[model samples]
Target: MRKTIALFVLTLVICSCVSATPIAVAEGEADRFESWNETDFLKDFVSNNLDRTVATAGEEKAGDYVLSVLEKMGYTTRKDNGLTSAKQRFDYVDSINGDANVGYNIVARKDVSGATEFVIIGCHYDNLTSYELNGEKVGGEGAGEATGVAVMLKLAYDLRYETLPFNVVFVAFGGNQLGLYGAEKFIGANQSIVDNTLLMLNLDSVGVGDYLYMYADEVSTKHEDFVYDLSEKLNLDVRKPPKDKKIVAAKIRDDSKLPYHHKGLLSENSLFLDYGVNTLNLFGYNWTGEGYGGESENHPDIVGTKRDTLSNYLAYYSESGQKKMETATALVKAAVTAEDFSAVMKESKKEKFDYSWLVSDKVRIGVSLGILAVLAAAAALVYVKLDKIQKNSKKAEDKSDDFQKQSEKVFEDF
Candidate 1:
């Protein structure tokens, strides 16, 4: 009886711990995050009926919305005009018109006097074409990545007035669904800006999932620590991929883990990765390690569909989820505001070069040939060994047959 009572007490304790609410930071530089209105801004921002298609009215309106928010925050905003050729290269052109279809990257800058290095925080505001399970064309909507756009807006607002150790640029990419065209263009044209950037944080699908995920790489330890610190404070679940595992956005269903290929950049962060930029991707939803059962925007069927609206997300996740998003926003803010973040990113001046030609065809061809040669050598050795074994076995069988025949004849004579 005493043991049973003790077990019950332990269960209650664990439940209480799990149910505990996250409190705002009472002291320190990150305390401004406590005042952030996470959902109010997000709901209004995402509510805009922006279709995510490249070069469409919805895309333009969405870009305008991002610019409006940044301008309200008192940041210098501009439409980067250099990515027109990049849009052409990606084949994001209209069928009716022969002109190259392109979307502008709304770049908002917060310059710090005497600070040479800058940080880039970006997400795609454009939506994708919705399709049915049978691959039939259906009506498209702006619900999928609206949450990500909201997150960027909130970040701009939260950090607008604060002076930091480095300059900051908040960029909303236009042609993400059309193969990361916006990001590709930004990288191509702004080689100088890209060089000065210390880190790039990409937010996507922030409105769903039970756990916060930080897709990290070798140079993003400071970013990882910031998210982890937030997790500890809020008692929120957080996950990072193991070193050997690929840094990817993945989907997890009941008992199964599948990789989510975003079609462009494979994942939005890959654009920066291809350029060897320091990057960290923050999103809600895990379905990666140990498998999170909580569903969020990472759901393949839900995101980029008409169903990914504000009402649906709120109803599906409940008010607590919004609160969680607030916490997530706070954590990201903390990371951005951390004093030591800029110190780790010092680098020599970067020369202007087209990253499109960064990887030569000859190098790719050489690597492919090397792999093919190794595979061919392995196959040949395996075939030779198998052939020798088969020949030896056949010889042994023939010898046995001869002996049997000789024995049979001997027995007949006897």
Candidate 2:
């Protein structure tokens, strides 16, 4: 009985000692990134083609890659493009209207509108494989920008059939290495999508080992705040700068029609404002963009070199990176589905900050249970011994009475 009590106590103690943690659910996009293994792809891209120094063929390769994934995700080849001259009708239109061959904005559209709106998750996959100084490759080719394509494809494949509030369009913009041209092409052609787009997240130089720097034009103050708050609550190390006085002022006086929900410059001065959407830009190296400095300045010169490969992170598994992506995706899911950014932020903060006092509470419960069990068992044993003694004593007394009765009978007979 003591042994049973001890065993029960031990089990209770163990149960109290450990508590489960929440696991990650990519929802539907497992292939979007194989997490740590992504470094292998980065290494492969850097070793084979560190040539994003030029701005032409790099974007085409990236664009085609996006198209392939979109096709895999059930999006047909884009036939009606409004920005690129390739789809035009006349020589005049092609000449006066346009002049280059790199590639067009690659966007895949799924017909099913799970939500009334659309969310365009874009990534600038173009690279300067060879930088041209006046139509010639300058210095040398650079590390091609392919990871954006790789990551975007991963998302495309993952979200293909998964239920979502908004249908997603994966975009690979060319001319990013040149001057955000590919991104510009996409925004220009899909202007309507901009207004209707719930949010725009662009992945650049991702899939490598580096601090993921998230950026936003003047149109993303509140959204940025939401992201930062979410990240902090989760204890993630992401690069999101608080808007300085200047940035806030810029967002206020901007003169564009697009409504800036973010608490930045209210004026629509930049193209980001035209869409009424938020842009999350990723700078792979040097962190020249806003709210991105520190070690980023000391990192590799990813803008022009092929050094920005998966191997950049081969030595270390980046928990920080995964947390960033997961958090961002969760944020998008919340804002789009709930139509409430504040609500999502609050909820995520609660979840991220919440701790189950499981370890402590369980310990107390276990100890209490063990003590009670031990006491109860000891009482039962004592009761059993007492009952035995009482029974034995009763039997002896009855024997004595029987003997006495026998003697009295003998006397009476005599």
Best by TM-score: 1
**Which is the leading candidate under lDDT?**
1
Total clashing residue pairs per candidate?
Answer: 4, 34
Scanning candidate 2 in windows of ten residues, the lowest lDDT window is: 1-10
For model 1, the stretches where C-alpha displacement exceeds 4 angstroms are 1-36, 50-52, 76-99, 129-135, 138-140, 218-236, 242-267, 289-300, 347-369
Stretches > 4 Å off in candidate 2? 1-37, 40-58, 73-102, 134-145, 207-210, 217-220, 242-270, 284-298, 306-414
lDDT of 1 at 5: 7
lDDT of 2 by residue, 208-287 (tens): 33455555553336566676666666565566534442222111112233222232221111235344455555434323
Worst-scoring 10-residue span by lDDT in model 1: 1-10
Q: Cα deviation in Å at residue 75, candidate 2?
A: 3.8
Clashing pairs in 1: 52-126, 52-127, 208-296, 209-296
lDDT of 1 by residue, 1-414 (tens): 000000000010100101111122234413333454666556656665535455676666667666655544555323222111111122244222334565677777777667777788888777654423357634345443566777777787777767787777788887665455566667766777777777788877666665556775533354456557656876765566444343335421111112322222234566575566767776665444343222444343356555666666666655655655666577677766767656544421122123343246776588789999999999999999999999999999999999999999999999
lDDT of 2: 0.44
lDDT of each: 0.57, 0.44
